[model samples]
Structures are given as structure tokens and as C-alpha cells.
Target: MILPCFLFTSLFMVKLSQRAWNNVIIVSMLALIMLFNLSSNFLNDDSDAPAFSTLIPQGLLISTIEFSNAKVERVGQGWRIESKLSVSKDLQGLLDVWQSVEVSPFEENLQWGDSQPKVTVWFIGQAEPIEYYFLILADKTLVKLGQQTYQLVNVNYQTLIPTE
Candidate 1:
């Protein structure tokens, strides 16, 4: 402990040249900059966050999806649509859109209209069906699941719901 103290005092006693002191300052500044950058890289990491959020949970096999007027079901390897209203021209394509659609969380609270359509979805092995409500506006399509609402990233209301 005495030797360490002596060495520490000797280091300060020996006067460094002005150029050497400048070099030391530059090196210390570079080290501080490197440390700051490394800390920022670790602090701002977002690897856990997904790039895009899906409307449905990943790998969830939907057994039945009931729209406002139509009910679509999975039969064997294909899908069956039973409806009293107008059916989509490509029912499979519509199913694909629902299955693969991505959504982002709505930032602001919106006052939804009274004429919102309800969509009920039942997954395999799930006892309770998930209910979703749609607030289709002139420009955007919003889906409310439970209390949170999300905006459909790519699909519009007309594509999912067809009318004559």
C-alpha cells in the first residue's frame, strides 16, 4: 500500500511536457467518446421489439372467423364461407389478408362511430372466442381488441368487407 502511494505521488511529481500532456488529453477524450458510444448502443437497443405487429397472434390457427354477415371456417385443408350477405370474390384471399395482416397501435384516443362492425374469431383449442370491433373511416381502418385499438397497416375496410 505504501509503494502504491509512493508511485502515485511520483507520477504527479514528474512534470509532463506540453505535447505529452496534449496527447494524453486527446487519448483520454477518445476513450471517453468510445465509452459513451458503447453505453448508448446498449441503452438504446430494441431487439426485443418486433419490426411489425400482427393483427392475430403468430402461429395461431384460426378455426372460425365470423364477420358482420359472413362466417368463415376451416374445413380440412381448405376454408368454407357461409354467408347471407354478399360474399367476397376471393374468399381465400380475404382469409389470407386477415391471417397475414399487420397492425400498429393507435397513438391517440379516437371517438368511434356508432355503426361499428363486430368481428368474432375462434382459434383452435381456445374455449373463448376473441372479439374485435372495426371502426372503418373514410381514410383509415381501425380495429379495437378489448380496450386497445390498432390501425391496419396495409389492408382497407372494403377489401375485408365486400358489399353489393
Candidate 2:
């Protein structure tokens, strides 16, 4: 009976050690995976997709415009913002102004006339709705888009704005 007890105890101890080693390996593997992910952002991989701005989707139109980048939402089509300068009121007019703009990279902020007066415009396109951000600083405008940024030259600031 004594010999049998000794054999049983030894078997149990061996099984316990095996389970402990397996747990340690699993934990180590998980830690390595996490470290790799955290470092990926710093890699300068040119093939990476362009980072689009955080404009709301399903917002086929600009709902509201404020100075501080808040109070702006991508409201769906058929939504109208009836403020003093509302895009829905005269979209065709604004499009005309945008069409006249020369698409180029923004170089310098030369004009400072319209700096204090910031206007937010909600734009609607045939395919989708997006918010068009602009500084409207002068004859040229600094426009912010999701996929890219541009400087629209030789544009009328007031006509491009949405008005009631």
C-alpha cells in the first residue's frame, strides 16, 4: 500500500508541472504579439493607404458650421440648414464658385482679412455628402478634404458661402 501511494503522488506532480509550463508559453506569445502591433505605426511604409480626415459618413450634406470644428455633422440628403448663410439654399451658386478655383497645394497664408470670420459649409455631391472646410482668407481659399488638401486660388469668398 505504501509503495502504491508513492507512485500515485509522483504521477500527479509531473502532470502539474507540464500544465504550468504550457500556461507560461501561451502568455509569452500573447505579449510578443501586442508589442509588434504597438510598433507598427512608427514604420514609414509608403504603400500604406492615405489617412482621410474624420468627416462623418452618411452625411451627404453639411448640417451645421461653427468656428471651432465642433457643431458640424454630416446630415443626410434632404436636410437643410436655414441659417444666414446656408448651403442648401444656394448650392448651385456655391458650386459655380468652387469650379472657378484652381486646385493647388496651399503655400502661405498671405491674406489675413477673413481670419476672424470663419465659415463652415456643408457640401453635397451626387455620389456622397461631405463637409468642405475652408479658411476663406482671401481671393484664394485653403480647403480641407478627406483624401487630400488644396489651395483654391482666385475665388470669391462670399459667393462660395451658403446664404439664406
| Residue range 1-164, candidate 1, lDDT tens digits | 69857865775788999997788679869978999999999999989884448877787788998887788889988888888876646767777888888899887898876579988999998999888889888888999887888999899867776344
Q: TM-scores of the models, in the given order?
A: 0.64, 0.39
lDDT tens per residue, model 2, 63-111:
4444332233334533233344343445444544444555555545343
Can you give the lDDT of residue 159 in candidate 1?
74
RMSD of each: 11.8, 12.0
lDDT of each: 0.81, 0.50
Residue 82 shift from truth in candidate 1, angstroms: 1.4
**With candidate 2 superimposed using the best TM-score fit, by how many Å does residue 51's alpha carbon deviate from the native?**
9.8
> What does the lDDT come to for candidate 1?
0.81
